[model samples]
Target: MLEEFVSLGKWWLPNNPEVVVPGKLSFSPVSGAKLELIGSFYSSQFEEIGQVEGIELPSDFVSIEENFNLTSRVRIDFIKPEEIIILGLLDNNEEITLYRCSGRMKSFEFVKNRPNLLFNIACIFRKIHFQDEQNIKLKSISVQYSHLEQWIGKSGIQAVILEEENKIWISYQPPSNIHLTKIGSLDLNITFSPINVNPFDFYLGATYYKANIEQKTYLTIQNPGNQPLDECINLLISFRDLLSFAMTKPTSVISVTGKTDVIQTKPIEQANGSITLKEELRETQVIIMFGLWNSEKNSETKLSPNEMLFLFSDVENSLGEVFETWIKKRETYESVFDLLMTTMYTPSLYLHYGLINIIQALEAYHTSKYEGIYQDKKVYEKGLYKKFLEVLKDFPSESVDNENGISDEFRNALKGKLKSQTRFTLETRLKEILSEIFCLLPPNFIGSLEARGLFARKASETRNALTHHDKEKRKKAGKGQELVQLFHTLTVILQICLLRELNIPDDSIKILVERNRVYQKEWRPSSN
Candidate 1:
């Protein structure tokens, strides 16, 4: 792995591999790049001899000796290792080798014997490829959706079970029928590929040792049309977001590696300063998810942390369809998805913000899913606020732009209220969202909010109290643990709402939410 990461000081183009420059490649999880390259600062030595044309020197050596000194940045091509070649096609139909070579002239030296220029570049990439391929078409990519192993429960290494019947001893070995499972569309499939293990038996004079096949689930994504690498990465991230929401934990990306079609003759061997992948090389964070149960995919045995909101195995059959539907509405669900993820990712994050975020997410989801107005747009803008604006237009403009006047000050205040005027209040949206999602939850999961008449109004009070720091209003809001519970309850509601957005059915959503260990234990229900 280290060998794959370290590159010798040089790089070049595939079409023109001869012109090599002095540079080094660097990338990794902990050791991302602060790259550097050095080039000769002055070409005076060559110029003092003669000018070069098609050949190294002039046809007539006596033409002139032009002195080339260090004045500006020098442009040079570099060499890439011949074994692993990669190419990227641009939108303009021009093809180019992909390189993450980004750096600017750092310093030029005037020292004796050795004077050179330096370049400092940052080579870490997350959202886009370094070459700015815009939308790079990738054949396939490998990613580890964290905690997926525990969820899949399909590691072929099964325990050897022993049984005794009618005084006779017998052994019952768990079946080894594990195979790769593929899900999702033909153009894009999510494959749960199991690692291969060799089965062997070793025998000594009086004893024999049988080797069991060890298996761990591997995840790979395929894009038939060679979809953009960035999109594929987003798909990986989005699916992970779904997992994180389902598990109620911050599940970081485990590992990522991509490959172009091997038939393209550019099988990545050791990509130096580029995203080029070779031999399935990877840089990932320390292992965070571990196996809880030792069983294969076909086995009914599975385990999950009590904290998980829902187990992947429970909804997996429907997940391909769920993910397919969910991701298509990225733009529509971006706000709610981000807010939900933010709460999940940052567990110690301020609870006040979490409450506010979920509430905002509810508002955003409702706003997108259903369209309504507190007052019709024309009625409010033209009939309502317009009357105020008209009256203000006749009045003197804001005197000195201060708030104490009935001029532009009042006018601006009314305009500020315009956007919210037609939208549902935080309280109205909260009740509306809860009313719909509560029907999808287990019976009295959070008790009957309508009968108790406490959750929604108190939530609105708390949101406004914390947001505006309203001391008087704070009297009605929850304190400390109560506030945290409010936030937790709201987080649960948003999770269910998002599942509904994925077209998960009402009864299924109810069962899934009830199965949550935290939902069963931690949440406090409204009193009857």
Candidate 2:
């Protein structure tokens, strides 16, 4: 899925020496075809014997020859006058092209003297494999045969079924024991009674989430217990299933808890509203944990509002210049990064880079806060909306220029890229990629301008913090309680932003927001 070959003659011999009755004779090819030429080449011979009347026949017989060499063709004859025949081999030249005979005859037409030759010449064909297709493997083989005019009507192909309790299984076996694994497909059908198992008991566990505005996601997995699971097992979770609740009518808060080993997650907060993740699992689970964010969705970081206003103005003012430069190198990602770097200040970038503990707390607060609104919509919705607007109004302001010599043009360009977020802003383009930072929920989450703006501001801050650190700051950054606080705040913030999209519960959302606030109390408040 075979090509060129020559044909040979067929014959029937009756009691003659040159053509002995019911005997086999091997013939050699004179000129064409390739042969491995195993051992020596000579004419083939065979003898016929009558079977004892009551002896049962064996399915297969073993031949003890080293190998047979054929020059061109061979002939076989049977003493019995039975018209039935089964062709097992070509009995002629070997194949060189892409067409092959399946060792079965098309019609029962017997050429008076030529019994071997057929109307259509046979060739071999080989199939081509593609990169994407799965390589199919043979699992089992079977064959069967019956005498003509059996009681079950026709003698060919009968099904075998195995039954146990309410279950059934089917298979087929060939008449001979030649181990013909290449006989192709045989169907099997089975049904069985259900086996009971606990829904909470699992061999493995993991979680993930996404946000509506960001491209990144957060993910975590439990340490499988004593028994190790096969690595081939995959983690699969459908966004449609996870976000099904988000798309549905709002509900009350729900909560669950376990050892830290049972869950994997990033810090809750960052400059951006929150993060989200989606999971893939090898098996399905009915019960799962989801954390809702409680940080005020509309709540603003200290400098968030002013920062947004400044960047928004700077972007509008420099739009024409930025777009012009962007168009010149529109094909590259650097053009976009350069644009963002222009408008975002060191503090903004610093927060965006996610280095400071306060930045993480900010992210967590927003994530949990917004998530709580969805969880306890009736109680929190109006207040959260008010806070969100207040935060936006008081957002941070960027310095007109930096002494470090990072240009205003570059800052604006960078912010432009980050804000617009085309496919060009993928992690592949950025140096310290933030795939987990900006988690977008699968089904798409919506929020007020303040909620959205806070998320965007955090993203800018996280980026700045990551890229703008000097040697002195780097030296002072230690693996202490601050680092843990940063991660927790980051997770809480990201989780809230993600959960809002998921319509997570108020209790779960508040847990993360409160967690972040606890950590943020230790750090200096951001400059507005």
Candidate 3:
């Protein structure tokens, strides 16, 4: 298996061969320019399947380089039994190659020196459909990183291909929190244009970031019963190890700060950085200073933790000590909850804002239908807030006693106690209000809102566990489970809500429902 696999590196081979051996195959840079030649020769067929690697001219699709570097041999056992599609970034243009190598039929050689070269050895493998002559078509290949070329063989890509496809479409402007993950299930057809294609595959491969992990998903063309036109397809959806790049190496520690209030810190280039103990880092805090705000007089205002809290507050405030006092007073969890409640009832708040807008628009349509006589602008809002208060009044903050068999009064008292100290912080209030408004939403709105509620609850739980929960509880919670659930739930809710709000009036909402159903059908307790 290993011998056949090694045959892939060699693009050229000696005349007809005999015995074949299995061994490891690897790629190393050759010269100073952005050129690399992949080399390999098979022992059995005595042929070279040489690959000329270098920048292809901007105008030309295929270019043969003058010189080649890097030499290796083919491993017979490792010869891919299926069709393979690989991508090479030549200059700025991307070149995709489909290789259909069967058995130990070929090989090639690479030159040893040169500096400017970059190659990602990962390839997408799909079953081959060979034509009579030389034309070949690959269907639904498993796409993966180059490192998986070892132990996993052709099957390593399966982890991504067979995994579930989760997508959501949001219709808000960017720079807005029109989140893709918070609404949880992503199978919905979202209205987003493509960014640069991840170099994972030349075609049928795309990716999006979720929880900071780069996941590559492929889209392919297939007939879905009578839908016309080519549809996007999936090959694999897997996470790549950040350390795969030879140019990237880890170091001890590095720190940087921001200059302006508007500057958000995102990685442009990652370099030598190491993980450290929380205590060590705590001693020397890395205060990333994104300018908070500025006064009219051009005086720069640095935001303290309390000032930052006020900045995110729902109510606008002045910049003086009065505003600071108000924020400090309002920073309690109860204050947040109250803001959440207000936001949930109002149409302009985070989660509730979208629902309110939709419901208000729908109510407007309903009123215009009956020409204002039947219009009850307050019905939706009324029902929503009533339910909000009801839930707030009834929701038990503490667990019900199973062994003690407590009385109803005891339970009620316990619930009230939980509520007493629990002031509505802005974040909590927003989540709760949205959850309630969504719940009380007309039948059309409930499904998506419920999903969003589930997502928010999960996120809240996870955040709590990370920030405040004891070690024992964290252990019981397991790793990343809550966060994943939160993301999934957010995806579903966002898609449902966005689809409904777009008011496309065709089958858009129906399409989202159908997609959700398709995903729901596959849900299992074990997977959760």
What's the best-to-worst order under TM-score?
1, 3, 2
457-482, model 3: which lDDT tens digit per residue?
A: 44444444555557755653324443
TM-score of 1: 0.66
RMSD of each: 11.5, 32.0, 29.3
TM-score winner between candidates 1 and 2: 1
The C-alpha lDDT values of all candidates are 0.54, 0.27, 0.27
Model 1 CA deviation exceeding 4 Å by range: 1-34, 38-98, 110-139, 161-214, 223-228, 257-305, 390-407, 418-420, 449-453, 473-475, 517-528
What C-alpha lDDT, on a 0 to 100 scale, does residue 156 get in candidate 3?
13
Error of 3 at 156 (Å): 32
lDDT-better candidate, 1 vs 2: 1
Q: What is the C-alpha lDDT profile of model 2 across 1-528, one tens digit per residue?
A: 001233332222122224312212121111212212111111322223423354443446333222321111222232122111112123453211211112222222233322221212121111211111121111211111111011112122344445555543332222221110110122211111123434555545533243122111111123223111111011111111111112111111121111111122444554686765534322212111121221111112222221111121223233223323333332333322222222121223333333443343333333333221223443443565445545444544345334444444664565454333222221122111122322431211213334344434444444344556656444434334544444443333334444433333445444434433422422212235
Q: Candidates ranked by lDDT, best first? A: 1, 3, 2
Q: Give residue 443's lDDT in candidate 2 (0 to 100).
A: 15
Worst 10 residues of 1 by lDDT: 286-295
Provide the global lDDT of candidate 1 against the true structure. Answer: 0.54
Evaluated with lDDT, which candidate comes out highest?
1
Write the residue-wise lDDT of candidate 1 on 1-528 in tens digits: 111143434444344445445544444433333333455323332323333334344344432123332222222222121122223232343333333433334444535533233322222222222233433345566665556667555443434444553343333333343223333432444445444433442233344345344333434666676554446555666676666666676565555655542212235545464556336423222111111111112122233556676665666567667666767665678888777767666666777888888888877888888754688777677687777667666765556545544665557776677646887777788777777776776665557776324677778888889889989999988788778777777777887887777787788778777777354432453444
